[model samples]
Target chain A: MAIEIVQCGALITAALLMIIGLVALVYLDNVLKKIIGAAFIGDGVNLLIIALGYRVNGIPYIFLQNMDVNSFLGQASYPLPFALVLTSIVIGASTLAVMLALAVVLYKRNGTLSATALLNDKKLGEENNE
Target chain B: MDGTIFIPLMVVIPIICAVLVNLLHEHSGVTKIFGYIGAICLPIVPILAVYGNHFFGGYQPLANGGLTVALPEAANAIISGSFLELFHPAITYAFGPGQQVILFVLGLVAMCAVFISIAETKKTSGVYLYMLFMLSAALMAFVLTDDIFNLYVFFEIAALVQVGLILVSRVRGNYETGLKYMLLGEVGGSFMLLGIALILGLTGNVNISDIVMMIHTGLVNPTNPVLLFAAGMLIYGWLYATGLPPFNAIKSEIYSKGLPSGSMLLQSFSVIACISIGLVIIRIFGYLPTAQMAMLAVSVIAMILGICMAMVQDDYKRIIAYLAVGELGYIGVGLGLATPLSITAGLFQAVNELVVTSFLFIGFGLVLYKTRTSKISKLGGLVEYMPVAALLTVLAGFAMAGVPPFNVFQSKYLLCQAAIAAGIPELAVIMIILSIVTFLAFLKMAYAIFLRPKPDELEVSSASVPKTTMAVMIVFLIICLIIGLFPGLVVDKLGVLALTAFAL
Candidate 1:
């Protein structure tokens, strides 16, 4: 009973973290803050995936020469989600790097990181054209 | 050719071309030749290949030895003793008639887009060509792969490639637009991952076929709260990826800011991804009326919002972008219906959209090419300078509005029939009304840009469009007419897809 509570608690915490990150992403106007928000979302998702694969009193998913297949499968934690998390982490890092690079470029060109400021400048350019 | 050999080749060829293009980045002459070959071959190989299931990693479960596994108590109650496995949990690609038809359209448009990029740009950059190839490969894999995780990976790669396509164009506000798109895309993608994780936790599988089988056999309860949450998350990802309502504003901005050739590929990505992911969702959750209704409502709202938004835009590119996004709703309506005929019509609409939208982008691209402007009010009397381009643009416009003897007309007609047959006459009526509004919107654009007197501030340059760009538009025009006249050629094959989907 206690173990089930811990697992459920971890899952709930992960979901809460994701919601908070999403709030920052949508509500925050600063581009840098948005990027951090994206990273937080990634971390929250990774945690959720890891939590899903967790097994109480389970060993790492490794094979030994003498071990039987059934016993090993029953005693070991699931490895697929862990492998998936590794790939997702790499993808997240690369996306973050690209986002930050674009932010740097935006800052250089418009001299502001605020999305609203950028929109204002665009609107101003349109008005000038008209 | 063997199914396994050719299935992987469809994805591999373009990837290899991207690498080669990057290596020869400084040699424009060599890279251009490579791009043409790569583009032409991507479509042909898929058409010639036989259709069947192809397994990778040499992991055929039946051939290795079918393993009998005991089911959990709940699953045991629904089925007999043990489950017999036929395929291993390896990367599987399913090639059917539907995949072939869609891939062919994607390939053709990609080829034309690549050719136009080479012809229109001042200097062809190898990295740009590389991004184009990578984007094409990612889209093809998105359509062809049977593994859910593989789809997610391709989705991420396609998003990054979209950003690359935007950044390399060097437009004024492109960096900002690309940043916003990437940030939102990351959040959406994480939601999709969470959804996939939920499914994996429930089914212990990532292969889509296996999950569907398990769900169908009642191993995974469709009514479970966790599964419902997963479905909701996946639907969120679908809406984001396809640029439905809230995402439509930013997506249209991305399209307007991108180069015309880039927009051509961007629209293709949107069409193909919507069909691919939408089909996956329906395959898994079609039993739930709420899920189907949610799709229907979103698509209907997309149609209303997209056309309404297009009606108010002054920029020519932004207008077309909104229209392109609006057309996506028609495809959505087809998928949302979930009937055999409706799914087929939806798939056909997807094919017609890829060609028609690209034709419009290229036709309008010629305007931007000659006049160096996208604002409609500042431009006028283009037909006097470029009559051929003007004619092609009108034809593409008419096709977009579902005028007779154009490709979209057939699909739109079929969609109406399917909707009414499915007991949704209001949807058919709404579709007709919105299409007329779309036609009027195009007319407004046409009169302002082509028929009105040339503005004093606007300089009508005498520089003619390149022969190659015009040739590409003419080819697309011919394709539209051919498909419009005889929709059976594609629809028959699409029927096979619908039947297969029904069987599943």
Candidate 2:
């Protein structure tokens, strides 16, 4: 029961991270801050995935010499989600880099990091002539 | 040799092309040759390759003797006694006849887009070509891969490549549009990952086939709250990916900001995204009526909003972009219906959309290329200047509006049929009425852009349309005609997917 509680706590933290990040993303007016929020969302998902693989008082996923294979299989923390999180991190970082780079360029062009100033529908609608 | 070799090559060739082109960007001559070769290969590889599943790194199921390490007898026994034995241990890409057809059409549109890209430009930028190839590779991966995780990897790649494609265009406000899309993508994409994670947590697998099998065989309870949440998240991601509702405006904005060629390819990616992600959703959640209802509801709204919003647009590009998205609702309706016939019809609509929408984008693109602007009110009497292009553009519009003897007509007819077969006759009426509205709306734009008297301030350029562009447009028209006259050519192949989906 204690182990499950700890696991649930971690899951809750992950969910909170995601919620906060999403709130920052939608409600925050700053473009750079929104990017940060986006990063947080990725971080939250990574945490959730890692949390899913967490085992209470579990053995390593690898097998050792002369180990009991059945016990090893039953007790080992999952390795799959870890591998997934690794890839997701790389993808998330690259995507962040692109978004950040785009933000920098938008700032240079429009001279503002305010999302409303740049990305609002009114601004977009007025841009058809060019 | 297993016929699966072509499957991986389908993805690899594009990446390879991207790298080569990026390297040779400084040399336009070399880049041009590489670009042509790469574009031609996109369609040809699909044609030459046989269909089958390719297990990456040769990691098939342990039950199939795919293990490299000798496992203990006890571990093997445990795996053998449960659903684990049948689960794929590696990333899998399944290339069925349906995928083949769709991929082929995608490759064709991509090929034409590239052909036009190379020919239309004074000198091709390797960076632009690089973005194009990467976008194709990502979209192809999305279609070919059976692993949802693999799909995620390429999903990010697709999103980034799409932004790069928009940025490659010198269109005003492109950077703003690209950044905005990325910002929105962050929300949509992160949630999508969370959804995939939830499914992974529940099923202990990332391979879609394994997850599906586990759920179907009662290894993982499908109705679990976590699983339902995952479905909801996945559906949210689908809406974002395909630009169905709240995202529709952004998606059409994306189309309007790209070069005509780039927009042509961009719309294909969205259509492919709609098909790929929507199929995954259906496969996992189709049994749930709520899931199907959600899909149907969004699709109907997208159809209505897409056309109505388009009718009010003054910019020709925006109009076509909205129309493209509006037409997307048909595919959504077809897939949302979740019946075998509806699924096939949906798939068919997707294929037709790839062709027809690309045709319209390219046709309208000619006007944009000749004139510096895409505003409908700024131009008129184009038929007097380029007779062939004007007539072809009008025909493309007809195809979009579902006029007879065009590919969209055939697909729309199938969609209506599928909707009725699913016991929702009202859905059929909606589709028919929308089809007519689509026609009228397109005719309005056609008249404004092609037939209206020339404005005094309209600077009509006398430059001849590129012969290559003409050839591509003619070929596209022929394809639409062929499909319209013989819908069986597509529906028969697409039906395989619907049947196979039911088998799942």
Candidate 3:
């Protein structure tokens, strides 16, 4: 079986997105940016799954009425990646919901979304106790 | 035919109940009924499934029979066992004697406590939904899974639901604690994902059996950096999830943030997550001597550090929280030892800890309700007034200390014996010494709160005994006694199954 160049490109793109997401979470102080980074990584995964099904000049995975069975069998895109993307999408949505829920809870408690404010509060509380 | 629909229903039933109860939240009476039905149904489903699957063998293909649940492929790579290796990932669910039975029994006891708790609190619906979700997910992951990736997915789902349940208590400071939990959980999730990616990259198969077959052929070389990195990532993930040393601070903070009722839920999740994660690592990397060493070091750190921290705590819940940390260490030690005896002992210890700790945490909940405080030094002489509560509380504390005729003692004995058999006499001695310290500390607590002289102004009313709360405590206590008496009933069966799971 011949490897598709487009599929290779998509995998590399997904890998880069994941690396970027990791860096953003680690290096950025802003919480919203961190969330966006996570979203990008999730999108990248969805893209990779789609790409895995790609075949050069392959016809869409649809049946035409009156088409011969032999011709119909040879043209369909892979079905497994389509199913995987659906599963990944559900997992990704749930993760987003949780991350958002936590972020909202944090905002309600502390009144600021910045990491700096959290650090400041901790330092202040410690000094007062001392 | 290990029944498929029943296993999936294990998760589905509670979820449906959660939705129904949440809709009827305004009608407390309706919610209570829903709660009772849920509690009773949750454990029966899995227990009945085991019986039906064993007897009927109406085995439909799981994931179209792609995933085969066999022991050698699931646990030890080299050990051969009879089981089908599924072509695609399907539920290759099987049962034996050892950890699976222990977990089922633990799940039963936890459900009993949860039911009693329904009567303990009012206007609290949908909490049981999360509880059932956590239980079913943990058990499904523990028993049915044949792929490492599926196990990781269940771990993530359980962690997410568990953190949500912890915050649902809506107690003060809970948000912050939940945040910490989410952060740690995210890191753990990332590490586990990376580990899965590495394993797949090396072997091109996510199904555990194929990975093992590849490893056996030297196609997946042990010295591969990706494999080593995957191993490290897996261990670190286990540490965070289990709340081992250095991670204890977060566990303490999270447990303290929730009300005791909520803490009861958190504690059980902690036990399940730790054991499941440990089991996964042991399954994947059991052949590696270095991985065994790392597990041993973690077990030691958890036991020693947890007890040391527990000793100085004035807050009663914090003390128990620390002790829970240490108790998990005993489980880890059993897995680390990896001998048949030790692994069985560790799994048995896990069951003991589940029952005893639920009782202890719930028993403490009654105190929190009465005194409106969890501070040990602030209250005394509870035995004079709340005699029943005091009795249950004492029983739970003693059980935790590995007292005879209590659930934990049997497992504790086996852990020591197993450690000795493994030529680690020092671990056995350390465990013995830790048990002594644990007993002394609990004794101090018992004396200060229940046995010591009563202070004036502390009122004990018959009203203090919530009928529902009493029901919960009694139910939990009965489970502890029942399991303590028939150790082999659960251990022999669960151990055999767990050993078989590993062998496949």
Highest TM-score against the true fold, candidate: 2
Residue-level lDDT tens digits of model 2 in B1-504? 766798999899989999999998999999999999999999988877787788888888876775787768887777775767788988988888888888898999888988999988999889999988999998889889899988888888899989998987878888888988988898888889989999999998988877778788788888899999999999999999999998999999999988878887789888988989998888877678899899999999999999999989899899989989998999999989998888998999899989888888889888977777788888887888878898998899888888998888888888888877788999889988988888898788888877889888888777789999999999999999999999888888789877766665
Candidate 2 docking class: medium
lDDT of 1 by residue, B1-504 (tens): 455578778889999989998899899999998988998988897888788767786555543442355434443343333453443558888888888988888888888888888887767778988988999999999889888989999999999999999888766677777887898899889999989999999998888877787887798897989989989989888998899877888788778777888899898888988888888888888787788788888999999999998887778888999999999999999999999999999999999999999999998988988888888878999999999899899889999999999999999999999999999999999999999999998888998999999999887668779888899899999999999999999999988876665554
Question: Can you list each candidate's DockQ?
Answer: 0.48, 0.76, 0.19
The candidates, ranked best first by DockQ, are 2, 1, 3
Worst 10 contiguous positions by lDDT, candidate 2 chain A:
A121-130
Question: What is every candidate's alpha-carbon RMSD to the true fold?
Answer: 3.2, 1.5, 5.9
Superposition TM-score, candidate 2 onto the true structure: 0.97
Cα deviation of B53 in candidate 2 (Å)?
1.2
- Regions more than 4 Å wrong, model 3: A1-29, A33-86, A116-130, B1-5, B51-86, B89-91, B127-141, B217-219, B453-462
Candidate number with the higher lDDT (2 or 3): 2
C-alpha lDDT values of all predictions: 0.86, 0.88, 0.70
Ranking by lDDT: 2, 1, 3
Candidate 2 Cα deviation (angstroms), residue B46: 1.4
